[model samples]
Target: MSQEVRTVEQQTPSNRESAQRMALRPVFMPPADIYETKDSIVVLTEMPGVSSEGVDISLERRVLTIRGHSASQDHSGYQRVYNEYTDGDYERVFTLSENIDRDRIEATLKDGVLQLVLPKAEAAKARKIELKSS
Candidate 1:
């Protein structure tokens, strides 16, 4: 199994009149760690400020994609001060091989971390064959 990160840019309107009115949103690739076990592959990603309802995961044509959205921070009573960290959306994609069992994939999110488990197919598991002596 292999993992790849891609950045997708949205095209603006071709019309010159409409291009000036369009605004482009920034997309970030969150840091992720992948581990391979004897029977499964585990993927963990850090997505701070993202809630469970704001996450979307999908698999298409052997490509697995994860997207996360974080709500804007609320500072209603206090005036604006020095700012350093910018909150944005997260996007990532991974390519899966035939050895993975897509039907049994599982995922969990907790404390701004996302964990995904990709189980290996039954036929893909390693097995030892015994020989019989006549």
Candidate 2:
């Protein structure tokens, strides 16, 4: 239904200086599609050149975050090269409502595509109201 985009920043005592330097890397928002079913909500994100090990999915304080890092391609034999694509990291956030079951959420990455399944909470799922004849 409705979702909001959010950015999360984590600060650690040791990595504060390094984190500031790391911010120079380009951060791209990979394209994503989100759909809802009767039981869960599915999110599909296109993160080309990103592997399963390079992806991180986390949910904290009702904020779902999807982050991926794509390594740059290596052209060993070629000398001069013109490039149209840039290798960078991806980050996207979605604010979830109480309808989502945070504890049961699942994520999978395959072929540079990340899939997230957010199951609906027990009280949020639709239920049939039977009519009782008095």
Candidate 3:
């Protein structure tokens, strides 16, 4: 499928500039799926270990940004065993278009998944024109 959303600038630990500050913990770019319908665009982001309260979303000047923070679990009185999963924060940015209705956009987070609904502006929606017999 064609990808609608794109990252402003993908940053990685190794690829990051030297002047850029480092995060104590790993920061991940949460995977997101973008779908377009007749009325709106839907985005689904997967952020495991993140809760609703940990999600932060902002939009300004047609730029949409999402941040998800997750605290690593502290296993008290437990010894280090096999390790697999790591805790970290999520971040992503998308440049939106003028066709989107900014005021009507909606966002919801549930079960570590974030769903965003970007409604299209009235002028952007498809309409059928009827012809009258002359």
TM-score of each: 0.75, 0.77, 0.78
Q: Give a tens-digit lDDT track for model 2, residues 1-134.
A: 44333334332212253345347656677888887777888889999999887887877777777778787667788764687877777777777664678888899888888999999888877778999999
Model 1 Cα lDDT, one tens digit per residue, 1-134? 34333333333323343334234334567888887787888889899988999888887766777878777776799876887776767777776654678899999999999999988789877778889998
Global lDDT for candidate 3? Answer: 0.76
The residue pairs that clash in candidate 1, if any, are none
The window of 10 residues in a row where model 1 has the poorest summed lDDT is 5-14
Per-candidate clashes come to 0, 0, 0
Q: Write the per-residue lDDT of candidate 3 for residues 74-133, one digit (tens) a residue.
A: 689987687797787787888765468888989988888899999988887777889999
| Best model number under lDDT | 3
Considering only N, C-alpha and C atoms within 3 Å, which residue pairs clash in candidate 3? Answer: none
lDDT of candidate model 2 versus the reference: 0.74
Candidate 1 residue runs with Cα over 4 Å from true position: 1-24, 132-134
TM-score of 3: 0.78
CA deviation > 4 Å runs, candidate 3: 1-4, 12-22, 131-133
Predictions in order: lDDT: 0.73, 0.74, 0.76
